[model samples]
Target: MVTALMELKSLRKAYGETLVELGSENKNIVVLDADVSSSTQTKMFAQKFPNRFFNSGIAEQDMITTAAGLASQGKIPFVSTFAMFATGRTYDQIRNSICYSKFNVKIVATHGGVTVGEDGASHQALEDIALMRNLPNMTVIVPADYNECRQAIKYAVENERPMYIRIPRINLPDIFDNSYKFTLTAKVVEKGDDISIISNGDTLIESIKAGQMLKQKGISAQIIHCPVVKPIDKNILKLISNCKNKMLFTVENHSIVGGLGSAISELITDEGLGLKLVRIGVNDQFGQSGTAEELLDYYGISAIKISEKVIYEMKTTIL
Candidate 1:
């Protein structure tokens, strides 16, 4: 295992920097934020391209409809706000105005999942993935780290489509470098024969640590980082099918239902892969006010908890 300490970087910060760069390169690029520019870090874009940036002031639905209007004028509008408001509050506008018209609007929502910390359940967006993925013509992505987030944003800007990218509030360890290329397909981070561990977003780092812990116990885990949740990657089918033990695990920062785990489960069921899946996430419960670290451990999605769950499943299945 590589023991080097990786640099920590914030996905929101990466998004802000990348937005500024993309805005400078493309005159058609415009940004819209629903009141929380500072929190979502779209204030950076607002500062750089003041003329092109719009603040809708807490009306997420209005923000979505306005973005659609911009798209109709041939401008690529990137919208930003908290994940809870971005998806849940603006679902109707997003579905009707954006997706129905096939508008070229990108929704990059930050502070996803319980990692929003002290903000509590009302602010946390545990169901945003489920809500966004169900909408027709919507491309959903939850980037794992800083570099991936940067690349994903660039990809969204280049590709004219209705895309939703979820950014976590916390700083994560750098998982990829400058040369790393972002694609819609899932990337296999580690190869193993004993079990397959699929994850994305903040839980990805925890999954990696679990893989290391499992290795010490003689368990070879195949760790797959799946950043794109919607338009479920066809390549993942083959990767999971190739797992020797047919034991699959999906870890995510969202709910077990309608999140990455549910997506993978649906794939397995549809294909009749007959793989046993153990989803690691919030078990249909609302989050409480706590530190991100505390919430992760309490929810049993931490590295130690993930490893323990995998080991327990392996033993129980063997017996």
Candidate 2:
């Protein structure tokens, strides 16, 4: 269990501050936004480095292509916009102008998943991960909290590659401290012998809470936080292979079909782990307008719901 009290912090706020810091450190570091700087928190970067920032005025595709052009000229372009428009609206440009050429473009898409409350399904990007992960040469990262987001952004800037970082609109509890180092590997937040619960992004906090709830019900649960969605870490495969019990559950704020759960499923099947896996997420459906809290519960990815599902699955497996 985490010994310190978790502080609530905004991922986008951390991302913006990190961008400003990086901008000051690297003269070649530039930021591009698609007319949503305030919402995506890139306005902070724009304020700090006016000359290095560009607003493309609602044109996501043009912003991506422009970033690619900048990258080709040795500038490390950090692109920002709502997740839906960032990925869904500009997939062709990202695929051709960026990923195809392996341009050094950092796409930090905000307002991901169903948590963009009251915006409904159109604004929510439940399939962004799926879209980005399938693209060649694109590195996908979904940081668990503010600290991770900061580190992930720094990593993206320092390492020149075609990368996609997803940031949610809602503030999440601090899962890692300032000393925490971000890596492209799975982290075991809580260790147990009975079952393992894998998650990332906003769903990781709930997975930790669900682990606690499961412990009270005499079900020892392990919590694994996977920040990188693509290039599934070998450490995760090793952990599952050594588990005492072969049950695994994946929870995410996005759709289960092509999100973390799907990635894990591919890993298990390809590696022949033979673990019994259950996926918990938006079950092949679109999001509706509701509070962030209400939508989490409604989609059955809340801590309470996760614990309940684990208990039920355990009982059924025994029978």
Q: lDDT of all the models against the reference? A: 0.92, 0.91
Candidate 1 lDDT by residue in tens digits, 32-122: 9989999889999999999999999978899999999999999999999999999999999999999999999999999999999999999
Off by over 4 Å in 1: 1-4
Backbone clashes in each candidate structure, one number apiece?
A: 0, 0
Could you tell me how far off, in angstroms, the CA of residue 234 lies in candidate 2 after the best superposition?
A: 1.7
Look at candidate 2 and give me any clashing residue pairs: none
lDDT of 1 at 109: 97
